[model samples]
Target: MPAQIYALDISGRRTRPADPLSGHRQESWRVNLLNNNDVLLTQLVGVVGGEFTFNVNAAIRGSGSIEYSGTPLDWNQHRVQPIYRTEAGGAAVEWPLGVFLVATPSSEYKDGDRTVSLEMYDKTKILEDDLIPASYQVAKGSNVITAVRAVLALSGQTRTAFEESTQTLATAMVWPAGTSRLRIINDLLESVNYFSIWVDGDGVFRTSPYLSPADRGMSWEFEDNEKSIYSPEFTHDFDTFDVPNRVIVTGQSDGDTAAPVAVAEDNGTGPFSIATRGRVISRYEEGQEASSQATLQAIAERLLQTGQQVGSTFSIQHAPIPIDLNSVVAFRRGVEAIDVATTLQTISYSMDTGALCSTTLREFIQ
Candidate 1:
């Protein structure tokens, strides 16, 4: 069994009396629908799910759809939890795939049957819809985190798990009326070098400081061993044509004087570095509003770190693990002499009963 689907029964026998859980497969998948306030609405039954996809580049980073053979119910901005049991039997534990919100819902009738499909996205969707009503600015001497928390209040998204950054704003960041809250939040995160942003399994807006894959080693492993959850087929790919070796961010002055330019370059002996590559693969951008040189430098470094060259990504399948883009796992496909660490860049899961997962991982070449 892949997903090994199950339902939530807080009381009574979950499985058979004697056979509490499967010896080999542990437990099944469980899902729950919740209201906007996160109160239990109902446990979804007889529902089949489409692919639940989460990618780092997407604005609405996480999305999925679920279909059931019944008329649609009132469910816009409603939440859902895709759950699974970690162990077998009464001693088993439950973990959620993610806490997602219903984005759009549709209903159709055919052959005397009514089918309803709900399209869901993560909590970040709310920020996308919210707009700043007046001129907004995080003053030069203010704390960006406080400003971020206040902006999140615009959409009533207070459940946040953020690393308290001590980055004092060196320059006032300004946005006009009608600016997107998501963009503002993203910019604020970038200024503090805290770029990893996502709504976690419990629908909390989670943030963490940016770090190289080389600095992190933990969690899970994928090997060529026959018993491993990873499928036999392994894929290795390189996107080297567009690899960037330098990032230059120019500041556009809000008033009279423009801020100085800031640039980040791969200066070391790595294959993608400017010295080794010979030819400079440069990416340039102008800030929306002028910022101090320190701020511009931070932005330049952020852009460079996120867009690295020699892009080697691998495609693999693994048992549904409580992992996200922030996760870094070790990998070894010994047959082709391929042994390298991997950082997940794209993840997609088939959320149907007994379904599995697929991910594209960035080859961490330190």
Candidate 2:
């Protein structure tokens, strides 16, 4: 098997052929990237970025640590961009994973060996910053796509980072105090069924509708044989806390009379079942017109109907390219079971250890 390529470029620390001692190393380096629950190996557009730890052996130390000479891996002054490449045509080709944010570095000495571990985060950290509360409101009657753009603009993200949104939203929205931009945008997207958002391979933040498995045009077949490279795990959940049998939608503010109320119920529950499994109250969201009771009822019906279904999650290994967040995927569970369709929800990759690639998918009930 060919060796995986790992390279690093520090913004403040530059290296060249002329300098006798430059710390930049885009060639041979011993570094291992770590993954956590917060982020996955697959680079999805809206998902939080996984963390990486770079382990540098002391034997490669040229002029001691960055604390003394500040040659390489500067903790305070430099920003790191991790570059990934693969072999093709007997030469290395640029296979960019994504940009990384380097945290502080720590060192340890054991058995006459010195190693340094540098923590790093993906681009999702850009949304973690708190936004100024003054710039949080979107005007009424604005396009949903435009509302998202306005939020990103106030969050310090550049216009170049945005991609065209496939869905349109035409609701008035408000931003609460002390809220992060990520939280607000995610809420708005979900309200309109625009559940797909993530940074692409090219580092652009994209927004789109929830893609069904058919939209992606990819099918994965798993056989129960020893020669097969695929393994699958499934989870079925029915949480009453997340489901609501009755949904009450409250319309926009009116004068003296009570505000319009629209209610929806599921008649399918068993007689002995809990009279009310849950109750959801939707207020002037989901493009519901304030003055229209009919629009409020439509919103209530959508909420109640989506809340009454059995949900499932499927995870499998060796997922192919383009099998990313919100990609609708078809699954074949051998001859014994019928084919099922699900949406790709999460992905993880590991090239150093077993070259494993895995994906988790869920049935989009709504």
Clashing pairs in 2: 45-198, 45-199, 46-197, 46-198, 144-169, 212-328, 213-328, 213-329
lDDT of 1 by residue, 95-198 (tens): 56678877556777889887777788888888988888998888876777887888898788899888887666767888899988999988887766676467
- How many times do residue backbones clash in model 1? 4
lDDT of 2 by residue, 1-366 (tens): 011233223342323312111122122112222232223343222111222221111111111111111223444443333333332222333333444445666765669555555454444456655555664665555556666767676656653343445434334556677777877776566545554345544344666654333455544434445434455454444344445556777654535566567877665453212354434323223334432465456557655544443245566665223233445556566644736666655555533423434666565442
Residue 366 alpha-carbon offset, candidate 1, angstroms: 1.5
State each candidate's clash count. Answer: 4, 8
lDDT of 2 at 261: 75
lDDT of 2: 0.44
lDDT for each of the candidates? Answer: 0.71, 0.44
Poorest 10 consecutive residues by lDDT, candidate 2: 55-64
Alpha-carbon TM-score of each model against the true structure? 0.84, 0.57
TM-score of 1: 0.84
* Model 2 stretches astray by more than 4 angstroms: 1-71, 75-96, 111-114, 133-135, 159-172, 188-192, 211-229, 232-310, 335-338, 364-366
